[model samples]
Target: MKTPSAFYKPLAIGAPEPFREIPVSLERMIHFVPPHIEKMRAKVPDLIEKVDVVLGNLEDAIPADAKSDARNGFIQMARDNDFGSTGLWTRVNCLNSPWFLDDIVEIVGAVGEKLDVVMLPKVEGPWDIHYLDQLLAQLEAKDGLSKPILIHAILETAEGVKNVEQIAAASPRMHGMSLGPADLAASRGMKTTRVGGGHPDYAVLSDADDGGARAAYQQDLWHYTVGKMVDACLSYGIKPFYGPFGDFSDPAACESQFRNAFLMGCLGAWSLHPTQIGIAKKVFSPDAGEVEFARKILEAMPDGTGAVMIDGKMQDDATWKQAKVIFDLAKLVASKDADMAVIYGF
Candidate 1:
């Protein structure tokens, strides 16, 4: 019989993640005041059904005095309520903060079994992760917990971004990384006031037609960071997630942003508002036409053989691999929704 270490060895080295094996799918962290625990609890049922993960925001949004209350409230809520399969996660205070040790102590001691992942912010280097990993292991050992709680780092600082690959590979508990664009912008000294999503000041110019004049416009300031972060996460065999789409009212723009990340190999994007949830699900889930085409391609290439023509493009091993991406996502999403399964013919 293979030992647990040997059993897990194959999965440690950039192995293709099992399809639909999403550990935790979360929307943005929901901020609430101490007095709003009842109100937050009222909202939980609706949120759990709509989202795959719901994280209690304990770090930034909570007031200093209320941090204690929020942490206590989250623990109580975790004990009292059942989030079912919708993974429960929390954004703990940074390790440098005074609240860091207490936050971990309380969460791990009280409700460690209930928590899925602890989102650590401003992770500058591997040492940050190593600290958390050791602490978490000690906590797990003390609590007699069977499963280890995962750690997720926010790539928000320049140092963090610079050492993202090392950070991702820091520990077995490091499950994924998210791009925290707001803090990242501030850390990088980007001249932007908004939290995240779009920036009008970052754009490109289209050339003038008859050498009359040139026009410039804004583009995504996050493109470079997103691409770099995605590459790092991919290299380390972890999931990459777009942090937040702050434009809650503009679903179209949110969808466009989420779609960009989806196309670039990100697993998911953050949804701050309830309205943005559908947009993320729609963008991340494969479209019907693409799913049909991929299905057709697989049927046509039963042997997975040489290049064949389809839609004026050569279909071969490479193309089939691309088609599998769509097919797999379609199947994954279809498992949860019968309507999607019917539409995709899975």
Candidate 2:
């Protein structure tokens, strides 16, 4: 993964590191709020305390004529408030859109210092990241920015999925990648009319026997893509995220979807509505019983080598790794919440 010579390389001597490697636990939920909506911006400060990441959506949520308004709105909102460690991010328009270039220049030149991740939508390949990397570098240099702005790609197009590994390794400033199911479906000519949810009409059924009804096995449409994405991000040591689930009305389904991603190695998912925020946090966080079970396994394997039996279950090197994953997340989440601290400590 050779970095482009024209890309922004941090100068060492006096300033802090230009990029932030966001911890997995800190990114379990990214709430998408439209920047152009005054009502939304008015509610942002309150939302910040609840969500891990509040993305000022300047892309799909904003109307065509209102693109410029969203751009200006992002800068004003960014400067007017402080996001603390609850990362402040913005999604610019697509690479081929008219709004994309100005979105970067105006926002980055004005308040680029405040932004955590500049998310680009419909990224087709490494070329998209390379272009953004160089453009951001140019903007940073021109604006006299003290730190480099990081990049996140929306892996929506078929080409993007095909080359996702390269995209993950595309830029030195790449912070993460997200799975965008809506555009991905349209790009692949999928028949689903829904945003990102699974369709009941799509399923596998066994053959009927003796006039008995066949068993229908419902499946998740996003499993393969998300699993592949997790592998790609892990290989590059960057984060991977599950994109939005538009079914705000179905909390159970949303939780199940998020849980699947968490088990598959994703660090987070998008929360489109307020209802989705708590669901994501709960689903992505380590389960209390699971955490206790993991602790038992860890205690049983104190030497951290070979296999052992714990509560009638076989504990091996693989089991130890899995337990560590859950416990590490538990420790990180505990540092933020006093209640979680007590639970994890126990």
TM-score for each predicted model, relative to the true structure: 0.87, 0.93
Q: Candidate 1 vs. truth: CA RMSD?
A: 5.0
lDDT of 2 by residue, 275-340 (tens): 998888888778888899999888888767899988888899898999999988887777665676
The residue-by-residue lDDT of candidate 1 on 200-303, one tens digit each, is: 76777897788877788768777888898889888867778888767666777777777888888887766666777777777877889999889878888877
Q: What ranges in model 1 sit over 4 Å off?
A: 1-36, 210-217
Which residue pairs clash within candidate 2? none
Stretches > 4 Å off in candidate 2: 1-25
Instruction: Provide the overall lDDT of each model, using Cα atoms, as 2-decimal numbers.
Output: 0.75, 0.84
Write down the worst ten-residue block by lDDT for model 2: 6-15
